[model samples]
Target: MPLEIVMSVSFARAGLILGLGLTVASGACAPLRSHQGYIIDADLVNSVQPGVDNRQSVAQVLGRPTIASQFGAEDWYYVARDSRNLNFQKPKPKEQITLKISFDPSGTVKSVTRTGVEQIAKVDTFGKTTPTLGKKRGFFEDLFGNIGTVGAAGAGGPGGGGGGGRDTP
Candidate 1:
């Protein structure tokens, strides 16, 4: 083969390999989208009318709820979240929907409430340690601070003889 043709072929192969590598690398950085919990269908959700729908009908139309009320009024919550994560980052919610169906004692739906992403709260954590009320102590203090207090007076220790016990002369 001619030297010029040989060099041109080698360069073409290298360019093609480099282009493919770049494409693959770019795809990896793209955001990954995920859907969690109940899948919402506008028509189906709207079809459930208050006062007309009961537990059996609601379950058939919307399936089981994400969570049911543990206290107070009987309610069913259908939660849906669409999240996106780029590369190795934690997934953040891009959209959220919380559908609350409140039922009366007779199992009839009292009301249907829909909440959107506006209800999402963003909480910023301080660090690894939780923020607690009370005097902050050092590592050594936490380890040894209780040494003298364990058997101290009025501590209900073996010799402390709490006030509830009968007095001995």
Candidate 2:
């Protein structure tokens, strides 16, 4: 290769490598994030015995639950998720924990359970259509459907409308 051509090729290669390095470095420098709901420690959760812990004792140990059942069953839930996102892309879920504690009517912990991300359920809609009861018309039919119906209901004026005081012959 000619010296001039070789030198230009080396410069181009160097620029490409530098650009790649900067891209990789920028990603590596991004802060790893753990956006969680309720960050409860495993040891603390174990401290509360299922049969022994009452509402107050559990509250004291685990603090208030992230959410309590609003309807029928009395269940306290502590859920947390760890995710990391690059720039503004969708965050990737690294880990998830869900602890559900059921309480008896007497307000004592009845059962304690721990769950992982595997329990997550992905729901999907069935179809992209809705069934309705109505006549389906074509685009052109709907556009010109009312064109000749405007004054058909009454003479250009209101039906039965009184005319001038002088009666027409």
Candidate 3:
């Protein structure tokens, strides 16, 4: 091949490799989407009327609830979350819907309430080790701290007891 053609081919190959690498890198950076918990159907959810729908009818329309209230008044919660994450990062909620169906004593739906991502609470964790109130002990101290303290005076050792409430005769 001619010198000019050879150089041209080399440049073409380099361009092709660079393009492929960029495509793969861009794909890696793409956000991964995930849906968790109850899959909401708008029509079905809307069809369930407060007084008209009871526990059985609600279940038939929306299926099982994500969680039911264990304490207080009876409430069924249908939770749905759409989250996205990049690479190996923790998934963050893009959108969240919580459908709360409050029930009366007769099992009839008292109210149907919908809440969005605004209700989500972000809690900032301090550190890996939880803050505690105590004397900070080292590894060796925790391992062998009770060495001499086990049979020490006033610690219910063999010599710690008085002579069984009797006088020596």
Candidate 1 per-residue C-alpha lDDT over 70-156 given as tens digits, one digit per residue, 9 for 90 to 100: 998999999999999999999999999999999999999999999998999999889998889999999999999889887577888
Best of the two (1, 3) by TM-score: 3
Write model 3 residue lDDT over 120-154, tens digit each, in one string: 99998999898889899999999998897765667
Model 2 clash pairs are none
lDDT of each: 0.94, 0.85, 0.93
Q: TM-score: which is higher, 2 or 3?
A: 3
User: TM-scores for all candidates?
Assistant: 0.75, 0.60, 0.77
lDDT of 2 by residue, 38-99 (tens): 99798999987877999999899899899899999899999999888776676777788999
* Backbone clashes in model 3, listed as residue pairs: none
Model 1 Cα shift for residue 79 (angstroms) = 1.0
After superposition, the stretches of candidate 3 with alpha carbons farther than 4 Å from their true spots are: 1-16, 143-146, 149-169
**How far off is model 3, as Cα RMSD?**
5.5
Top TM-score prediction, candidate number? 3
- TM-score, cand. 1 vs. native: 0.75
**Angstrom error at residue 47, model 1:** 1.1
